[model samples]
Target: MRKSEPGRGLSVPRTGWRARIADRPARILLLGYLFYAAVGWGLLMLPVAQSGPVAPLDALFIATSAVSTTGLVTVDPGSSFTFFGEIVILALIQLGGLGYMTIGSVALLVVQHRISRRREAAARAAFELPSPVSIGAFLRAVFLFTFLVEAAGAAILYPMFLRAGVESPLWAAIFHSVSAFCTAGFSLFATSLEGYVAHPGVSLTVAALSILGAMGFLIAVDIWRTLLRRRVSFGFTTRIIVSVTLALIGAGTVLLALFEPTVAVLPWDARLLAAFFQAMTAATTVGFNTVPIGNLAVPSIMVLLVLMVVGASPAGTGGGIKTTAFATLFALVRCTLRGRRDVLLFGHRVPAEKMRTATATFAYYIGFLVVASGLLAATEAGAAFEHILFEAVSAMSTVGLSMGLTGALSEPGKILVIVLMTAGRLGILTFGIAIARTRPDDTAAPQPFGP
Candidate 1:
């Protein structure tokens, strides 16, 4: 080897994964999730993590689902996994829901009392926070809010679980509480929330936690600022997210209540409650269903499909195209219909960047849904086209509702869904960007478009 130049250290140039993702937050997030999923898969594959031998693919599927907080299960988690495995899944859910960077940042804050600029950039990208919001404040609020809500939810659920004759009521309550709040929808019960259809206390409590989690941390921060800190008013994004969420929930509830045959057969009080629970679950992308989703009529299915596509708000535990993006699409249409150029919502003009992002998100979602659905249709030749489409949407949206198709998926189908869940958890645009090639001169001024 050549001798080093005078005053030149022997440090070799940084190369490989670290250098590649150094400045790329999207790549960092994407790989971070993959790393966690891989670790979770390995841990879950051990003998101690399983009650019985689990197929490798199924273990990987469950691990991915937990890390994505998507809640789709190839096996009944309760029966297939032992206590240790369940804890592993729960840990994955918490990590997934909180996000890899978020947890890392919090830990750093606790230990070092300061976050590095690079880590701060990653956290900002992960959350897509507004310029006015400080990353430190937001992360602290997120941690506190998550634990408080989860604790309260568990407390409320403990007595309900005990009354319902559940085995290990305390553990069941705690597990389900975290699951709901994370909007992970992983249930210890074999039939999800179906057994609690008539239990308004449980249904509503779980629904409340899911809603709170899915509403996005920005909303919580906004509320804290407005109500507690005496800030001037709620942020525009918060207002829109709340409005769209409530509207979707309300619309889904009414449509399902009116058209769902299963809900129609229930007693009047339980019928409305079930419909509301199903609607809220779908809208929040929480995946818990009080009624059997498989037996629902076409109209009810359609309603759920819409809700899943719209999904929860941005910077939230849940996933989808997102409420703001969906709202922006509607605003664009309204403006275009009136022969105007400015996209306006709730008296505020939408920024051009936001409009473009919304349009791209909508296009990507539709494109991915169609492609995945067609592939599923081809792979599962005997399965109904409707079910294939539903599964595709559900997987891509990270809304785990299935029409009795999940357990019976072919190997290829399972793999496809795994990809979808990963993509869904990593926002579609972020996933696309992470995989796409980039130029060193990306900061150069934009050039005119050409056909």
Candidate 2:
């Protein structure tokens, strides 16, 4: 028996954590967040990163929010973070917004001056593009489009910032432009866009940037190509995205105007601007509120809730279930009701695989929303259900529009929110995949390709 026991060490080991992490794309994405969050937390903890010592939890919280681009901050970026720290936050926003994959590809392109097969595959996976397009071309389009829009937005905002006599107008304009286009919602002003609530130029510029970002880079590329080529045709996905976005904006504005007496009581110009800003903010998931979010009527908040949950389109800076997914689910239901064999939208059949994914995504979103809200409600005893629900939805959608409950959340509540925000940004499917225990390869052996 002793001699037989001696051979135990000769057997091969099972799969390791490294293999699991390396094999799953979702795990790579999750690990990327942890790495970035750790770096950000360390940077933010530095004395130069802040005017005073920040609690470790607060530093970690801010780092997580910034890296997720969730914008659900316990501490104000403008006051809590020093200039160096603000820059760090801005850098995190950009990194989170543009996505690490895209940024890595760009850096690779710069350093290597050639795209490797592995790099191309990584970019393709990160972007989740269905059809293969040249990775270099796609990266270039995204990079150029982003900078151009942000630059234009900054130019539009500079005069307004200067007119308002904001200290460091240039910096304010630059920061806001990046924040808006990235849909990060990190404002320099303690009151957010409240100071510019009545200023059409400022509100409009911010709204424009948010909308453009939320439209998704694919739609942007389509629009650009259409204009450049002088063609009117666009893809079905692009049509659905644009149509839903504009419709949400219009419906949200009208609903807010009707429901919120506070907004209705403003002067005609101010009233229109306020409604538009709020609508755009919700629809785009930009999270900048010109008016006091806590003062919003229940009905108006409901409208914003729906908008936030629907969120922006796929591949955009914003988060939530996404516009296309929502639309596809609607189409699927309509087809079932009509006894049709296939889901049709804009005269094209929606693929069954896409429809299934949409349905699954919707289910996952609702599941997360309910679970997060329940956890928050249990932890935050004194908070109203409505406020807790709003906070939960906002955090889960990465919309960041709070009903004044964010700053008052208990430690448990904050942890719940952090989880929701991470899930929202990483996406439900990706997060699920990362956490799922069943590894596909381990379930069964692979068969021949032809079979």
Estimate the TM-score for candidate 2: 0.92
Tell me how far candidate 2 lies from the true structure as C-alpha RMSD in angstroms.
Answer: 5.7
Instruction: List model 2 lDDT by residue over 37-144, tens digit each.
Output: 789989999999998778778888788788777788888889998999999998888888887678878888888877766456556655555564566777878898
Clashes in model 1: which pairs? none
The numbered model that scores best in lDDT is 1
lDDT of 1 by residue, 238-262 (tens): 9999999999999988888888889
Q: Candidate 1, which segments miss by more than 4 Å at Cα?
A: 1-17, 230-232, 440-451
Q: Whole-model Cα lDDT per candidate?
A: 0.90, 0.83
Clash pairs for candidate 2:
none
